[model samples]
Every structure is written in structure tokens, then in C-alpha cells.
Target: MTSDILLLEKNMHINVFGLNHNTAPIEIREKLYCSESDVPVILKKLKDWGLYESVVISTCNRTEIYFCSDDSNNSEESIKKIDAFLMEHFGVALDWLKNYTYRFCDEEAYRHLFLVASGLDSMVIGEPQILGQVKDAYRMATFHNTTGFFLDKAFHKTFNVAKRIRTETRIGYNPLSISSMAIELSKKIFGELNRKKILVIGAGEMCEIALKYFKKEGLTGIFITNRTFQHAQKLAEDITGIPCPLQDIPDLLTKVDMVLSSTGSEKPIIDKELVVSIMKKRKNRPLFFIDIAMPRDIDPEVNHIENVYLYDIDDLKGLSQQHLSDRLKESEKAHTIIEEEVVKFSHWLEQLEKNPLITHIIDVVEETRSNELKRMMQKMKYVDEETLRNMDLLTRSIVNKLIHRHISLIRQNGSPSLLEIMKQLFKFEEENEKEMDSGNEGK
Candidate 1:
């Protein structure tokens, strides 16, 4: 195979091997999840291990790794290596991952990632959170120098395509999110959120979005708290609410009817004992806790307490599925947009595949034409400039027409055999030059 064709083939082997809501339950996903700070460390480790071009997208619903590892085109071996890396990082065994993981290769992997970034593959269809998470993963990969040219360009293109999909289609028509779905489920238990007091913990993106949904539903009292008191104070100012210092959470918990926690803390912030004490202070009234953080801010065991309803990220997936079923029409529209982008990018890849052969052909033809023109002028130096110009234009037209079909063919398929054949047939080297000189001598 020609070097150009070989290089293209090598780079085309993209693989996505990881677990998502479809293949794994929340328990498994949570185990596989990485905190945002942990993203760069894992990506750099992959780079050091030679899985250089890769991105890891970890959210409450899914934790997937997309990488290019085409060292020998052994897809099985490449996937195994990736799984082993995940096993080491997440402490999940490779055999266990086989049951809870889904794998996509080449174009399938590309389409899957596009769907994910477009929010079609999210637990909450059309949620805008996934796009930001996807960008964060790409950014982390870039910062760690783990991504190569193909991955970097592909990620930027993916972002553009995702934006187009969101805009051109009715997918985000209602603009629903996981946070909104959490509110929807809460309404089932608490009746109406407008009358209920809410406490928003952490001023991160997830927390910000959830707070917006709650505010839209209307609030009796809004309170914001963060590890950084200034961030909470800023968010509270914008929303016209109270900002409490982190130290005041135990006191604040008793005043709020609903608590939404989405912090980056590695451990549970509200244990069962803490929440139990807070419930008694509320006169045993119903208090709902929604823990949206991956590591979970509210203790799962808190659900055991009387009049304390605690739901973590996993509990809301069922609610999100309801949103997905309701948004089928939007999903179809988004799929159509993604399909168009796939074809466009696939064509671009085809052109990239043809670059080397195209360059070689152009170089030979232009060089041969230049040498022929110099010979014509060397012996006939007295010739007029216009005549020389006419000769040059005539040669250029012939080369353009002759090469046009090959370019068209490459755009369609760009097979390696065709590239090799073109290289052989388009040889304008020494023997052909000698033949041309002989023909001139005869003339």
C-alpha cells in the first residue's frame, strides 16, 4: 500500500469502549466515574501508556473513553488495552466490564460521540449539561497533551456539529435537563415547589442549572452555599437569595424544604445522622434531598430516616426516561442533523486520505511542465513572451483535465490500489522526459 493510504488507514481506527446507562446501572457508573480534577491525571496516564489520542467523558449517567489506538490494527487487542487501563484507574476488572460496557469502533464511535455531545444519548434527552462535560473532557485532554491533531480537530468539529444540531433541530425546543427532571419528580412527592424553601449547595455548573429550574418554578426562599463563600454569595446575589457560609449548612438545612447538592466533594457531605437531626428540628415534616454530584453529596443511607426523602443521581434516571419517551420527535430531528454532519465529516476524511497522492501527482506534473518550458526557451530564446505564455497555459489545461477524474474518484472512495496505480501511470520522470526530447528531435 502507498504510504498515504497506510497512514490514513492507521488514523481511521477510532474506538469507544466504556460504560453508560444503556449497558451499566448507576452503581457501576458511579464506580467508573472520575472527578473533574481526576480527568487530567487519567488522560496523562493513558498518554504515557501510548493511548495518546483520547478523551474521557464522565458524568453521573456515564463514563466513557474515546481513543485512537491503531498501532497494528488489532481492534481486539487495542480495546483490551483500553479496558485494562480503565480497570487500573477505576479498579473495575476487565471481565466485569465486559458485561457492563458497550463498545463502538471507527464510524460508529464517531457517530456515538456526536450523539452524546448533541445530548441525544443522555439520560435526559436534550439536556445541555452533557455538551459542557464533553468540552471539559476535550479541554482536559488538550491540557494534558494527550490528544493529537486528529483528536483535537475532531473535538472542535464535534462541538460545532453539536451546536448546529441543537440550533437547526427542535431537539432543545423545550430545553429540559436532568435538574428539571429532578424537580418534576420532586413535585410528585412535595406537591408544588413554589411554596417550598430551597437550599442550593455548591455554585458549579450542575448546581447553577438546577437552581435555574427551581427559580423558574418559583421559590419561597432561595439559599446558596459553596466551599468558596464568594461564589455562593455571587450566585445568591444574582438570584436575589441568601448566601450562607459552609459552616452554616447544619443550621440552614433545617430552614429549607428542599436541598439540592452538587458539589465536587469526594465524600458525602450530609450523613444520615446529620440529616436525622435536621428532620427533628423541622418537626418531622417532609424534607426532600436531591444529590446530583457524582460522588454524591447527600448520604444514600439518609433515605432510611423518617420524613426524609433522599434521592441520588441514579434515582432520577427513571424520571429522565419519561422525558426521553416524551421527546421522541425531537430526538428524530436531532438524529437527522447529526446524520448530515457525519456525511460531511466523512467526506473531509476521504479528502484527507487523498492528500499525499494528490501532492505527489501535482509536483510531478508541474515540474515536468516547467522543465519543458525552459527547454523550449533555451534553444529558442528569441521566442516572444506571448507565445511562451500560450504554451504554459496549454500545458496547465492539459494537466488539470487529466488529473480531475482521479481527484473525483478519490473523493468517492480513495482506495489504496487506485492511488498506487495513479502514481505508476503519472510518472513524468527521466524516461518520459527522454522520450519527449526524442520526439522534439524528430520534429
Candidate 2:
């Protein structure tokens, strides 16, 4: 049964391996996080190491590796090698990370991808952001031409399954956006945000999301700021708030009740000294700061400041999980859709196994019909052109009719014996032609 399944997948296949929030803790996952700018470089390295096609999805909750290859024997070794590379890259030991990783091959891998894209596999189930992240990864793979036929088909089907899950189920209904979860954490730290002045840094999607949630709480005067003043001005206008230059964060910090910073900067934008000064200016009023940016926008030391509460992106996990429980029914429904799609994709893969034989049979029938027609045309030069054309059509139709049932049977059952028979038939024909050539050489 294993051999038969392998034969079927020899045509097209997928394999997935990696760690996520479910299997690994944030400390372990953080080590595996590959930035968008780092992906092309990693892709080149994978190709150099003889791994042909791959897509790496590295998000806060998961870091999944998906690959396609004609050789199945290499899958396990390839994964181990990748694991070693990640350990070296992140300066972590293999022993610490190995136990957290989970590997899936062939159909299981494909199904897992669908579940991931639909957000069913998220640590906080039914989160909507993962779907976009998955699509972005797919688009990158496509741009790099690393996405082959099997991956292309699998990703397209995964996307369709994700759409069906969203449309058919209430999985996303009343879903807690990450920004809302951030706000929930703020409320826990500070009794009520309504009277507190809120400072939102950055004009990115995450900043906007945070703004919406804070606005819902009727926070005291909101300040929108970004490196790009126009963006800050635009967002401020949209939210009916004030705009501050990014450089003025230190000056404005003392006035704000809460600071929510989510930006693309690689290092901390708000340091301990700056925040300490702000705290002094505010007479050390309890200030809640949420840093949702990768690499973290706020310095870790800021948390130690008097009356200042600093929360990093990972700190919101508890609140996010709490929201996930309410959407459990929708998550189950999404899983059902994923399971059904996996079965259909597997059936398509099985049918593809007979494609080589089907192509061979069609070529042989066409060659035979063409050769016979040429011979008949040469022998009967007096035959009218219309009569000859009609005869040719009749012979073509008869050949197709004869091959139809065989083609249908091969497609339906995908029997290995039938493929072996086709291979032997071709081999015999080649041997007979070689003998005929030998006879001519003797003459």
C-alpha cells in the first residue's frame, strides 16, 4: 500500500514540516522567524542545498516549511538539514528546538497547509491575519518561480478551501482582531482607558487596528504619529485625532495616558531614558504601553519604570486565546471543510499518476494512423482528395474509439499493473525495431 501511494505521488506531491505556537513556545518560534527580506536569501540557499521548490511562512504564531521534490528519500534528510541551518542561523542548539518541531508528508502535509491558511490551525483559532500571510507567501513563491505544478495546485486549492470556510461557517463571526486583544490587555492593566490620553505610533495596518479598538473605548485625546508626516496627518484626520511627528514621541509621551507603538523599525524606538523622562514629566502616572511591532518598538527596560506598564507582542497571547474559545464551533466547521478538500485533492493526485501512460498511448495511436494513411495515399494516387480525407477521418475516429475505454479504465482505477503493461509494450516495440535495423544492416 505504501509503494502504491508513493507511485501515485511520484507525479505531484507536497510535504510540510516546522514548528508553530501549538508545538513550540514563543522562545523556540522566535528563533525560527524569517523576515520577509530574508526569504529570498533563504530560498537561494535552499536551492543551492539541492532542495528544488519551497515556501517558508514565518509568522509570530508559526514558522512552517513547505517543499516539493521528485525524490521522496530526501525529505527526512532535507528537514534535518533545514533544522540544523535554523539552529546555526539563530545561534540556538538543535536539542532545544528538535522536540518542538512536527513534520508531515504528502497528503497530510497538503491538508495541514489548507488548515493553516484557513486559520483553523492557529494558536488563537479563527484569527484572520494568517490567511493574508499565507497568500503573501504563495505570491512570493510564485514570483521566485519556486512554485511548481504540485505546489501551485495545492496552494490554489488551499485558498479555495479557506474561502469556503469563511463563507460557509461563522468561524470569523465576532472574531477578536489582534488589535482588539491588545486593547483588552490594556484594560486589564489600567481600569478604564476612556479618560486616558492615547498615543498611537506608526501609520501601518497594525496601528490603524489599534486605533480603532482604542477609539471604541472613548480614550481621552488620541495622537497619531508616523515617520511619514502625511500618513500621520491622514490617519489623524480619519480618526478625528491630532498628529505628532515621530521625532516628537519623547516630548509628547508625558501628555499621553497610554502608548501603543507598532512599527517596522528594526530596533526599539522608545528607549528607557526617554520613557523615564516622560514618566517624570507626568509625575509618574500609571501609563500603559503596548509594543506590537516585530523586534519590539519599546525597550524592555521601559517595563521597569515606575508606574509604567510595557507589554510586547507576545504578551497578548493570553487574551487572544481567551477570545478563541468563543469561536470553537466555527473552527470545527472549518476543519470539516479542510478534510473534505484534502480527500478531493488526493483523488486528483491519484488520477494524475496515469498521465504518462495516457500520453504514450495517444502518441502511438496517432503515429499508426498517420503511417497507414500515407501508405494508402501513395498506393492509390487516383483516389479523389475528398474520398481520401473522409477515409483519414474514419481511421482517426476508429483509433480514438478503440483507446477510449482503456484510457477511462486507467484514469478511474490507476492500477500499477496497467502502467507496467504499457511500459513493457513500449519496450517490446523498441526491441522489435532494433531487430529490424539489424536485419537491414546484414542485407
Candidate 3:
């Protein structure tokens, strides 16, 4: 049992695969992006193909999948399947996959996840949005029943570590998000957003957050629009903006000085033709577009038009450099905190890995004792209640005494050969008997 537990600990490993902003360009990342609705299908496929647990975290900056297999021997095969699946499903080129995607196993994997959860790995280092994104991804995995013991522990610990970073360091102080960065770019494009009329497309969280920043900058006209008009109205009511219908986008584009768009749409919301026509209506007024969506809400070609400026999610990376430097010291502290938590988590997981085998050993021994006692009682004639209780207690005491050393050895140290001997003594499964016998024959 001791050796088996040790083997399990050695065999079980957490793995992570996929690309982030650092590894891949926005174009490559977007190709590999998995929407919230698309995650369950991927998770199910991964499980069907031998992954024990899985979670997919798909944000504008990254699309990473974390998973584990039941055995280490199967990990390579599982990773190959994942690579093939991601490439085929997303239509990613083989060269792109090799050039862009990253793979990490065990300590490296969880460390990457920890950095991601704590926002240290974000394009805007120390941004708080990635933590929430990680939580949402984990929650989605849980809802789909893809997460079990390993992932549950890893993610819960990640949350705690993120919270610790937030508490201990000033990393999250002033919290720079993609929305805040977009607002900053807008300020740079058109100085002083006060009294500026900005049309915000999509009333999602990103839009709401950017609107708050805009409101703080004293923006007077904030028009919110979405495919669902009610959602637009709700967000506009919350943010003190005017609610506009999706159909009114072209007309609104003619009026606003700037447009900030973030929607979950698969295709570009505003094309070059529409923007070109709107530019004519505005009489070549400098209209800036900040697209904070994954696939991008505004067309990239819109930047070609005279007096039109377009910035997608990747464009914000350059703007965040100064912000990243500002939080460098705090980020260092956060990294230190994450490393400490990673070590602690590794220790806890090791101890946890031993528990199942230990429990199974005790259960098997106890069952044997219980069955023998039942047989002995059936042969006896009319034993008193007190005697029967004493007999049960006697058997339990012997069983405990017999297995105490085995449990202690398991808790302390275990060897492979000893584990095999114990497995035979305790009548463990015979699946490996032939292999063991063949090895013995060579001796």
C-alpha cells in the first residue's frame, strides 16, 4: 500500500497547453480561442480521450487548457490528442501550433496557472481581470463536471493565492484592466475626454467597466448598444448612459468622436465600408475606434481610412508598458507570494495523494476481519449481547494492530518491490501478475 501510494504520487501530474499573448499574436490566439459555450464540448472530448480532468480558460489575451491524466505513462499520448484536436477544431496551421503554443507539466504547469490566476502573466501585468476570468473558467468546468479532486484543489488554491497577493501586496492597487487601458489610449488620441461624445458598442462587462472609466473622465455622451436592446438599456441605466439600438450603430458612428466596442460576436461588428461611409458623414472628423473583443468588434482595415484610427486588443499591449513598470515592485512581491503558495500546494497535494491508498488498505483488512467474525458468530450458540460486542471489539483491535505499521510505512516511505509483495499478500488485483511472474522468471 505504501509503495502503491508513492507510485500514484509519482504517476499523477497536472499539465497545461495552449498559447497566450506572449506566445502568439492576436490572430493566432483568436484562432485557438474557445468561447464559454464551446468549452464543454472540448472538455468532454478531452475526457473521452483519457484526460482525467480539464478546464479551459479563454480570454482576449489567452486561451489555455489545464488538465491531468490518471497515469503518467499515458500523458504523452493524451497531449498528442489534445494538440491534434485543438489544431483540427480551430483550423490552426501545424506551423502555427509548433511556433506559438506552449506545453508545461507538473510544477511548471501549476506555476504557469498560478501566475495566470494572480495576473502576473497578463499583458497588463498585475491586472485584476484575469483572476476573475480564471474563476469563471473554473466555475464553467465545475458546472460541466469536468473538474474533480486535482483541479478542484489546484483552482481553489489558485483563488486563495490570488486573494493573498491582493491582500499582501499592492499589485492590484489601482487595478488596470483592458478597459482602463482603452480609456488611456482614447485620452492619448483625443486629449481630455470631458464633454466628448463616445459611442460604446456592446453592454457587456468590458463595456460597463470602460464606461465607468469614461464617466470618471467626465464624458457627457455615452451611448450603449447591444444586439439585445434590453441588455443595452440595463447597462445604460446602470452607467448613466443613453441606450441605443444595434440598428442605430451607423447613425451613432456619425455623431461620436470615439467608439469603444467589446462584444462576443464571432464576426467583425463594424466593417470598413460602414466606417468609410460614416467617415464621410462626419466630414473626415478624426474618429478613434478601440476594439477590446477577442475576434475584434471593429474591422482591422478601418485604420486605412483617412481620419480613422483603430486599435484592437493587441494594440493595448504597447500602451500598458508604462503601467506595467509602475507596478513592477508590487508584481515582484506577488511573484514571490505565488512561488511560496506553489510549494505549499505541492506539499498538500503529495499528502493528499497517499490518503486513498491508505484508506483502501484499512478497508480491505477491516472487511476481512468483519467477515471472519460473522462466520465465527454463526457457528456459536446463543452468545450474550455483551459477549458479541466484546468479540467485535477484539477483532477490530487485532485488525488495527495488524495494519498500524503498514499505514505508518505508507505515510512515511514506500518502495516498488515491497508494494508488489504487499499487493499479493493483501490479494490486490491480478492484472500485473503475469508481468511480475515474467520478471521473476528472468531472475
Cα lDDT of all candidates, in order? 0.76, 0.77, 0.79
Off by over 4 Å in 3: 1-10, 175-211, 214-323, 354-443
Among the numbered candidates, top lDDT falls to 3
Q: Compared to the true structure, candidate 1 yields what TM-score?
A: 0.51
Candidate 1 residue-wise lDDT, 1-443, digit = tens: 13323333344566787788988888888898889888888787777766758898888888888887664545687677777877887798777799998888767788888999988898767878899899878766755557654575567678888898778876765434577667876787788888889989899988888888889988899999999999998999888889998888899888888999999999888898888888888899888898989999988989898888887888787655555675777788778877888788777665654355554565566567667867877988577745765565566558757766776676676687875577678752455445434533553
- Encode model 3's per-residue lDDT on 1-443: one tens digit a residue: 44333334444788898799999999988788898778999999987876768999999899989998656446677778888998789887777888898988888889999999988898777878899899888877765667755776688778889899989988766435677777776777788888689998888887777788788988879898998999999998898889998998899999899898999999999999998888888999899998988988888999999989998888776656555666887898888888898898888667656555554566577667767988998999899756775675566557767787886776676787777676766665554344434433543
Better of 2 and 3 by TM-score: 3
Model 2: per-residue Cα lDDT over 1-443, one tens digit each: 22223333344457888889888888888877889987777777776786667888889988888987555536878888787877777788887667898889888999899989988888767878899999888767655656544675688788889999989998876536667766666777777878878888998888887788789998879998998899999999999999998878877788887888888899889899887877878898888888889989999998898888888877776555655675896787778888899999898777765465554565566667778988988998698745764675477558868876777777777677876686576442555335434533543
How well does each candidate superpose onto the true structure, as a TM-score?
A: 0.51, 0.52, 0.53
Over the full model, what C-alpha lDDT does candidate 1 score relative to the true structure?
0.76
Comparing 1 with 2 on lDDT, the higher-scoring candidate is 2
Clashes of each: 0, 1, 0
Q: Predict model 2's lDDT versus the native.
A: 0.77
Q: Give the worst 10-residue stretch by lDDT in candidate 3.
A: 1-10
**TM-score of candidate 2 to 2 decimals:** 0.52
Candidate 1 clashes between residue pairs 3 or more apart in a chain or in different chains: none
